[model samples]
Target chain A: MVTAREEILERLERARPPAAARPAAMPEPSMPIDPMATLRDRLQDAGGSLQFATRSGWTEQIQWPVEATTLRHVYSSLNAMPGRGVGLSSKTNHDLADLDVCVLAAEFVVIENAAAWQRPGCLRERAAALLATHLIVVANATEIVATMHQAYARIAPSDASFGWFLCGPSKTADIEQSLVLGAHGPRTMSLILLSD
Target chain B: MGHRERAREFVADVDRTRWHDQALWFVRSKRDQAADLVPDWEALRDQASAIKRSALTELPELWREFEEHATAAGTVVHWARDAHEHNEIVAGLLRDRSVRHVVKSKSMLTEECGLNSYLEAEGIEVIDTDLGERIVQLRGEPPSHIVMPAIHLQRAEIGELFAKEMGSAPDLDDPTELTDVARRDLRDRFLKAEAGLTGINFAIAETGGFVVVTNEGNADLGTALPGLHIASVGLEKIIPQQKDLAPFLRLLARSATGQAITTYTSHFRGPRPRSTQELHVVIVDNGRSQLLGRPAFREALGCIRCGACLNTCPVYRRSGGHSYSATIPGPIGSVLETSRDPATHAELPHACSLCGSCTDVCPVRIPLHHQLLAWRGELALSGHHPAWRRFSLNLVAWLFVRPTMYRLLGRFARGIGRRLPPTLREDLLPAWTRQRHLPTIPKSSFRELYRERQRQPKRPRPQAQPRPRHERNG
Candidate 1:
């Protein structure tokens, strides 16, 4: 006698009440740092700064310790952005359509025409890159692929350049008719394109 | 802020002109494929949700433990109940240290707090180090999309915006060239910033550490170079341990950008080598404690900001992020807004295809679609529904539930609709349909067919009874 909707409603009704009891054993932040000391240290750490190695490309080094305030400032500023970032590259020889930006997300490295975006596997990689905080487009300067049409030439029939269309974070402003930020998606962008 | 039918109208108009809806829908399909690729996607989602729920359940204790451990590790932890409190604590911490001019990575919580506005008012200049954020900052605009704030913009528009805003060339059209120009602009700010702010992706209760995922390594660089480091996190962001991190980390980047992982998933437990800037964590409640107490929407707290639903939502695709008018937009935006301020965002829940794509796409498995449906009930109970919409919904319900009334109405509609003059009842429909005509319905209702079947003889009809014996069961 139970329709699917009825079963769902019934299950929902049977759902347990929100856990009334808080965990007795709560973990606390081990040792509260002297706020002043932490800041002083942070400013000193800033003296070290970050230096990029051309060989390994964009690698992340957290440094032994990260001051909470310094990190907060970085994150806060970063949060309020969709910076001027675009990934571009030109690789004349094509085994795939469009450049793969997937590797770029973590490696900050751009790969030449490794696979066609129209291809299932290749397209997935490209899509992942577009959604990333930064993008890498690897192509020969002479071989430019910008619009969806140029993409077709590079991608195989099996590979469709769908990922390119969803290039940024997916978002909506359906609440109160105001454009609220970060409803969903990256909220920022960085693109690295190979020039030569 | 709330959803205004007017903004939605504006988006619809633009959507029709640009066909941007199809573009977003394509992203939705990509999300679906990505989800489908993992056979254990649903199970992983369940585990992630369960982990987050468990973490929230034990938040007070975990938070306490985190504070103790982080402090021991040389990090300061501060508790705040709302944006003002969180910002105040942060500002107070800075004032104590004589710190000014902070650098930052993307932190939506700070944005919600209007931290930059607050800081500017407090006579502090803040620099955003993330590339996209810097772009919007230069243009003096709020981000449009979560991932790509300026997604609504074209290269030419950006060129003009930067040119006029940043004193760059007025006609720079190449996205690459413009980006290089901004890089130089932001690099200067980064080097000079005294403090850095980064948002917490996941705050580990056990280790007293936080994770910041970034593709450009902005968080790593910004935090590394700043004199002071501040991480602002909502209370709900805490997770139990690093062991529980794998599933989320694995899912976060891939489900979000289809990557193996983000470029940087840095875990910061303490200040650098000997000392880093004052390491302070503003553990903010800012509406969260109250939200956690509300059972229906408690799961909304588990969100990791992947933005899958926004990409998948048809309505969001057409309307863009501006229409919802909240800090967060899209289907998830509707859910968050409904929970935050029902009256202001009452109309948001209606902007759904009910396709359940959002629910399916969610990495944390928030049951977004169901929550969206639940909002309508919550909104109605709260008396937030518009009178006209309520009446229409009631009228539809009445007719559908009453077969006789429905049949008669169907017949009447068919008769009148078929004979309608060239100039139709335009106002009766949404503007989307003003230019398009609806197909006329047949005079009869499906119920008529059902009645006719019942009227037929009960005795076995030879042709029907035979039913091609072999094929009958088949």
Candidate 2:
């Protein structure tokens, strides 16, 4: 088990951005990923408050905060923001498990795709955290590996973990279509665009 | 609880036949079509799974938020950690409302927790309004399948049962005739029902509504015509929105039965606003909260109570649903039962072929066979297996520890297999192989052949492949 963990760490290291090119100034990437943002905009909008891990903000002083300031900020923005004239978020496969409707201040937020770390091993667990709503994907600008299989091939480790995002403001419409927010889990989720 | 023992009897009773097996397989096929229709079916499953997992991780805050928002929506959200508390709370609510006769649609949770008996004992007459549920209610038997409760019964048996119980003609097996009587009987009950109870399919968090999908349309009538609509649902039924239902509707009905969609998908946001009826939503935990924290059983929540697993399960197909001896039965039933007590359900995990058809058929995609395997580990840890079985398994493992002893025993088994009495080999095998034939053993063991081949190599030649199970002679 220890060896497995070690191997996972080694593979994740290869996927990480080069340490030698660390930015001189980094800020949290907490800005909302314009729900209406097209794929191209999402690809370009991968900086600022989104860089929660390296941020030196007031909220980042905490010890080992896995899901930090940026996520909370984005969650709040998504919560306070009203829905557009559009019907709803069209990119999800919502079923009985997730009610697409969400109460703005819901305690339970459903992150359709969860990744605390970009690695597969902890992504499922990390995205499950209450306030951890961001779904970060490190992808190149070009469509080299659009699918999961191809993504693994480019950076595939014999034991490397892989995961993507399905951010959702978890809700359920189970009770006679009476949309109840936070039936069992988080009521909000905000997707974080990393190297999209 | 009225049919609890009868349910066990029915299971054992039907274990003698394969009627239910074929019916369930048909249901499995329906589910396959439902799943196959959605392009993002796998992604949807993964999202549902991840949502449930995320919910489990943040239960405390989420529950609190649910409480806050639901309360704000004018819903009385009460928490019951167990089945008893859940039932008692519902009973007390009915008692408070002075409800004498309550109409209930099909709810597996109510069965799982046995809420009807508790209500009846409290002097409340509970009527199951759904056609299949009403039939089982009239016969005083438990539902055999999650979707088609009376799937095990042939139309003839149903006709007889209804006649014997409801005083219809004994010879009537026409589905149209039988369905008309049930509909009429339930309609009368629905009109007089003071409290309407239902099992929630998906609870929308954005709106304070709960959705119940049914083919009979009874859930709608029960809740709509009644003064009170009391919905009981496990916490995991929460989905994100109404528009998000396209994929689920495609998957759920097909998975549950094989319909492109159920006859009716009713969404009730709250009690009839401005109407005399009151809406009460009871969120039943009943070990679910505990299960929420558990990783292995967490996926069990994603189940839509579709018994596709039972149809494709060789063990469930042969042994039947009754052997499960739970409110829910079949592959999903056994897996969820483990969340309750490993020692009590020791036989469940063993009663499977682990063929993985259940997972394949599951709309939300729970790793059912893995859960069964995990249950075995739990059963072993709790020291629950029978002595002989454990002894034989251990003894074999110990023999395999010694290379030469294992080979000697293997040869001895081969020798005895070749010379055993024909009748003994045919009729005296274990129950697992009662309908299946034993595989023929070769004169020489594979290891012996491999070792010999190493000493004396021969030219390679292609041979015919082994026949699959369907083609094999049973």
Candidate 3:
């Protein structure tokens, strides 16, 4: 009996046309520009906020509670996260919904879409970056890339099993073309660019 | 029903039809704005098209390499020949895990397989996490648009649906509030569901991984909490290298929603470590190979499902996505559906006005209008058209072959229009004249006017005067 895979493969091979050389890479901008500024502008356009701060200043900046109901702060890193709050590991996935603010370290950030890349190895729970009402990603200024091509060049396939490019707060223009943020993910996303 | 009949029913509501038209036009304008920002936009499109062409040629080899690498990376791989097998494999996976509930991100492939209905029949509950998808799921309707599934629905209708389904405030119609209610409700489902399912946007053969891009973070969130993450990938989604994602990622969101990128573009290499989570990818052919066999229509597989063509299509915008009545609807949908069952989808190829806007707006540059035109030829060749229509078309073609007869017929029609009664004129062409009046005929044909101009005498030109040396030098 011919397996489904074999049948499918045979059909594909029969249908396959002669091979052609792939096109050359798209030319990158040759001019010098600040990737951090570009990232901040892109974030603003996408309904997200960005701020530059020192390590000590970022801790003082995100100290306030955002929502009246369940404003618990959560963080994966033990570094300079603000205020006394519950850690991501302390709560189960069910209770993580009550989290208002989450502070996580970004491996790198892309300027083209203002996306901050996060890895499962760094975050205590993978859901923390997504479950919180408001998300705050901490990234170094030197780690930003001007485009997705540059971003992909920085990482390899073996880096981590789960990684994401979180561009902005969850948004949707579905209902009558009205732009609404926080559809099913964080309502607000803020990126803090820390100078190394 | 034919696309025209369905479209007539949709446009019967004048106000709603106008609203749908403007809303999609607004999205198309946004896409234009986004495309204009990239300095190398055309270059990127060419690169993406070429890359997809190469991928199609190397499909079997690259698919084997992907399966091997993905399997070696601790991810299980399965092959499904059709929708039935795809649904069975997914249902069996859920059954083996004893999963009562599964949360799904937006995966059109699963929709093609009717996976939700299949799983529900097996006593499993499936919750869609994307806000637009969840609204339609609760309303027991298929998605109207692929990117924005509930684009045909207004917030007021969604509020009523949510009030019944999730028990929100009875009179709530605000989009922000409705989105919040869905977010809270789906958050619970995400945390409680035992398994997660997503559709692959692009699967990389070199990296042994796949990517899922969504404006909402539902895909990442759902897979994060579940013990099993099942990605239903079509066989054509495989790209040879990770770097090929650059052009696709740049074009996808821009073409779909005019964004530089989706909110989340998550790459899943394997299951997470030291946990119960596992990754299982089902590579689904589901008639795609059959589509590949036809060289004339094979380029349809290069579609990335961005729905830019739908947004720019006058027919789709005026009639709405439901008119097509397929899993995908619009130019790409029209081609893909006709390729599957030409007889059933015969009306779809004839639905377009041959405007060619879809061809121009397509990021991968698929010759959509040409494909639709080709389908029309095939459909006509199959002898499936109505006798009267075919006879009328043949009569017209015969007249066109003899120019003198054609011109005489045109003059005869003009004379009848001038001499006949209004009722008789209306009866001359009932189908076209039902909605509007016929245009008044001109005195002469353009060919006659051109010949007359050529026969007239030409005026002589005056002699030119030369400039002074100093002025010319200056």
Return the top candidate by DockQ: 3
- Candidate 3, B-chain TM: 0.92
lDDT of 2 by residue, B91-166 (tens): 9989998999999988998998899899999999999876667777777888866766766567787788778877
Query: Which candidate wins on lDDT?
Result: 3
Score every model by TM-score. 0.67, 0.66, 0.93
Evaluated on chain B only, what are the TM-scores of all the candidate structures, in order?
Answer: 0.88, 0.89, 0.92
Q: In model 2, what lDDT does residue B189 have?
A: 68
- lDDT tens per residue, model 2, A86-193: 113323111111222221221111111111113222211221222222222222122222222222233322122112122232222211112222222333333332
- RMSD for each model, in Å, please? 16.2, 18.0, 4.4
| lDDT computed for candidate 3 | 0.83
True-structure lDDT of candidate 1: 0.57
> Per-candidate DockQ versus the true complex?
0.03, 0.01, 0.73
Residue ranges of candidate 2 with Cα displaced over 4 Å: A1-196, B1-16, B240-246, B421-423, B426-432, B458-474
lDDT of 1 at A134: 23
Task: Write one digit per residue (lDDT tens) for candidate 3, span A84-195.
Answer: 3555445466566666777778888888778888875632456766777788778887787777788788778677787888877888776778888987778888888887
DockQ of 1: 0.03
In angstroms, the error of model 2 at B62 is: 3.2
